[model samples]
Target: MVAAYPDDVDTLVAHEPPINAVLPDAAGAARARAGFYEAYQAKGTGAGMAAFIAMTSWQGEFTDEYFAQPAPDPAMFGMPTEDDGTRDDPLLSQRSWAVTDYLPDAARLLAAPTRVVVAVGEESAGTYTARTAVGMAGLLGREAVVFPSHHGGFLGGDFGYAGKPAEFATRLREVLAD
Candidate 1:
């Protein structure tokens, strides 16, 4: 997968029942601290803090999405499918299904000689989109390449790790030449 920080994001993003529901702000912070301690007990302070930040950020984003969706019920709200069997519980089936069901289709697409290129940014260390790209590549049995950027197009600005269309065209030409 194109994950900048695979382990941390996956842990936070995979949690069921949503983090906000289980821990309030203070409790959440406390739990994060404890988790950091446990995680870094052997690794070091940097690893622990990184885990804390990743989990906390994931909690915030997931909480926002959780609150934005309708209340619990299969027809209205549920766990995202991609996360369903990955976890032991079920909350939003439809959402989970939507996220998990794309594998076959993605594999089919990647199987074509369409020059699939999975790009990751140097800065998106713990973002879900980056993680998702990496995961999709793995599922498709393809290798994802990391591309460093500076400002716009594929190499810079807020475009993240996404390749610019023009850059892709040029890269395609180079590939064909070889």
Candidate 2:
């Protein structure tokens, strides 16, 4: 974004971005992120996905105790236990780490001719992504605007992880309108 539109822009709405550019707990977050990869390497896709799920759903700060905890069963989260013979779990796979570890150019953003609105879900308060959103906004000297539902708030489907997309859109429109 900084490269493409550094001189001309209006508003940027970042929703639950894994931004650690100015996070106070950057090192801790990095360690916690490494734990997911460790789980994948040490165990298997199932265990790694489980750890990834736990990491994203975590309520508070990542700690040593969090890393020391056992991985939960994938079945509990509707994940199959049978060896699917597939390593592409998408979000939990190795390819996603670079995106997660991406640190935005804070200086470029701060000096940009754009208004940035950091957003997080109300239902996602205290979770890892929510914290990141808040942290990113703090770096911009603003507060994260809470939307109506969880991370998938923009999605409306009966996919078991459904969120209030209508209300989320309403809130998002409100934020963008500002």
Candidate 3:
């Protein structure tokens, strides 16, 4: 949207938007990218999803034992462990490397009139998404704006991942208003 309507938009609130342009380590980046595919292919939906949960929940870069880490239980997160004998998962089915691997056009972003405020979850300070948000903001010559909750901070009662949605919305509104 920024590319097509640079002038039409005013402020962009980027909440943990994974812009990989500024990731520090290439090897670590590749490992993280392959994490989901390896997990799902090796352990089916239940365990793979568990692995995915583990991956995203990681506080920092994937450790040396990341791949060896036990698959997380979907039941723990109120997610369905049993695959319904179908392979149509929009989230896990495809390796959309393009999105996570994206390196946004920093020049265009800076030149555009839109004010991009990168938002990161307070609890997600050391996580990959938070790091990525910070990286993107740094590229834009700014620090990410802190929000009230975690990565899913704006989420409320969805998939057992509860965040301070009301507070999050208030903070977001404040950012937009500024």
Top-lDDT structure, candidate number:
2
| Model 1 Cα shift for residue 96 (angstroms) | 16
Q: What 10-residue stretch in candidate 1 is worst by lDDT?
A: 10-19
Write the number of the candidate with greater TM-score, choosing between 2 and 3.
2
C-alpha local distance difference test of each model: 0.37, 0.79, 0.77
Error of 1 at 13 (Å): 25
Error (Å) of candidate 1 at residue 47 is: 32
lDDT tens digits by residue: candidate 1, 1-178? 2133333332111111122222224243334435544444434444444444455335233444433433222222221212122322122112333333332345444444444454444344344334444554555575444433311224433543353556644643554454
Q: 114-151, model 2: which lDDT tens digit per residue?
A: 88888999999988889999888887788999998998
RMSD of 2: 2.0
Off by over 4 Å in 3: 73-81
Task: After the best TM-score superposition of candidate 1, give how far the Cα of residue 165 lies from its true spot, in angstroms.
Answer: 12
Query: For all candidates, what are the clash counts?
Result: 23, 0, 0
Question: What TM-score does candidate 3 reach?
Answer: 0.87
RMSD of 3: 2.1
Model 3 lDDT per residue over 127-150, tens place: 788988888888889999999989
lDDT of 3 at 171: 96
lDDT of 1 at 77: 21
Give the clash count for model 2.
Answer: 0
Residue pair clashes in candidate 3: none
